[model samples]
Target: MATARDNILKKIKQALVTKVPVPFSTHTETADLFQPSQKELEIEFAEHFTNLQGRFSFCSNQQELTEQLSQLFSSRKWERIYCIDEQIKDSLILNGMNINPYNDLAGCDASITGCELLVARTGSIFLSNTTSSGRTTSVYAPVHICIAKTSQLVYSLEQALLQLTNKYGNHLPSMLSLATGPSRTADIEKTLVVGVHGPKEVYCFLIDE
Candidate 1:
């Protein structure tokens, strides 16, 4: 009288057995994975970032940054620069350089913005919606320029995330982006391409102050 389904169910039930649950603990201690000194982090980040084809520069103060900017602008001949950060704006103004307000990304030669943190392990820059330029500014322009202070550097990605969590708490930004270098792709015929989806050139102005 037992159907195939009934027989299968009975066989499955016969294989079942109750066992005591293993005791579990929520906490576990582990050795630190990243504990590099500040100088080490700076060196590693610069090396990695340069390997990824990113331009890196270190400045000691606002005056040094201004000088660097002047040299860079003169060499690159960037005429239509778009900047959103107030500090960068003021710096440019003080340098007697003209800055264009955000209008269309197509019209800008470069875009300058500030980042939340720089990851030493990966040579990545983290940005969030809370940044002055928001999410699109970095990708929209032909060239992306980041202004980061040395104190904002973290040894690893985990530390960077912890810093963000502590700073934002429950009110975290809507999005967090970590950019390692200029955008690149190799989708067509296995040929490598750069800057298809984002900036072709990425420059970081690292301030020691």
Candidate 2:
């Protein structure tokens, strides 16, 4: 059942995997780097996120995460929700949540999406049009909820690049966005204002799986 095309494709894939160099080694010359533990890293990430113009919250469980967010906006009388097209949409539906996909972000209470990748050091999430079902859903909405997997966390941005290259080969995504917090501007009388062009609230849920 094997054709010449199939054989060649397999060869090419094997070659690429074998030839691609592992850029960094686990061994480090510097011994006193003092890397923080996982708990410390999460705390550091939370601290960095709050320092930005937007308010952020981190949750470990799906039920608690959704409840907390729903309550936050429900208090403000927000009910409609908009979401990007991704795998998480089903999870939301199962939780008795409804999502509007085609409507403009201004019509919804929040936007939810998955990050293309995540950088652990700076607690940043990278979003790309190709990977994240385009950027408008995450960028235009007043509230953005980003769901991330624990396995996707990288030690640094450098490691992220390597993982990306490994996934897509030499050709990279056209737009690689690195988002640490909400969009802000200090234009009016030097007063800080959140959600100028992007989401006012960015909640990150680091899923255990």
Candidate 3:
């Protein structure tokens, strides 16, 4: 007269008799893990980024950066560039590029911002709301330009997170974006479409100085 629910519960209880808990151990040594040099990291990052259809460039100093910016602006025809970061704004002015106010993010041809970290292992850039650009500028524009220093490059995602944790401690940004490449999707009839939800083009300018 027992209900079907009782039969299922009884069977589950019987199965529990043979169940065993597994023990886990942790290791502290990572000596066997392969660690690449900074130069090697840069090489890997550039290769991976290029494979993902991203544009990558390097600058040794502010002069080179300004020159690169000039050429980039001319090549992309970016008249109104959305930039919120103070440092980036200064750089833009120094480079003689037009800077659009934050209010006109949607109308701008491209956006330039500073990133928290660049993951060399995956060629990804990490951003946070805590940055000067907040969060909208990076994703709202049709073309996104990220400026990062060579020192900001990390070997892998784990190292990036560890560094962030060490730097921020308990205070972390409300949002973090780990952008790998330009927005792309093949949702409609398996046709590849770019910039459907975000920037169609992404450029990373790595400054050595």
The numbered model that scores best in lDDT is 1
User: How much does candidate 1 score in TM-score?
Assistant: 0.81
Winner on lDDT (1 vs 2): 1
- lDDT per model, in order? 0.84, 0.72, 0.83
Maximum-TM-score candidate: 1
- Residues 152-185 of candidate 3 have per-residue lDDT tens digits of 8888887888899998999988888898889889
Candidate 3: clashing pairs of residues: none
**Model 3 Cα shift for residue 178 (angstroms):** 0.6
Give candidate 1 misplaced runs (Cα > 4 Å).
1-29, 34-39, 95-102
Candidate 2 residue 23 C-alpha distance from true site, Å:
16
User: Using lDDT as the measure, what is the rank order of every candidate, best first?
Assistant: 1, 3, 2
TM-score of each model, in listed order: 0.81, 0.70, 0.80
Decreasing TM-score order of the candidates: 1, 3, 2
Candidate 1 clash figure, as a count: 0
lDDT winner between 1 and 3, please give it: 1
Give a tens-digit lDDT track for model 1, residues 71-125.
8888989877888678779876787766656667678988888999999888999
Please estimate how well model 1 matches the true structure, expressed as its whole-model Cα lDDT: 0.84
For residues 1-209, could you state the per-residue lDDT of candidate 2 as single tens digits? 99999999999999987866656566444442446556655665666666664355566767766666667667877666676565777776667655555566777878778877766667788887775657587887888888776667765676677688898898888878888788888999999887787888887877655
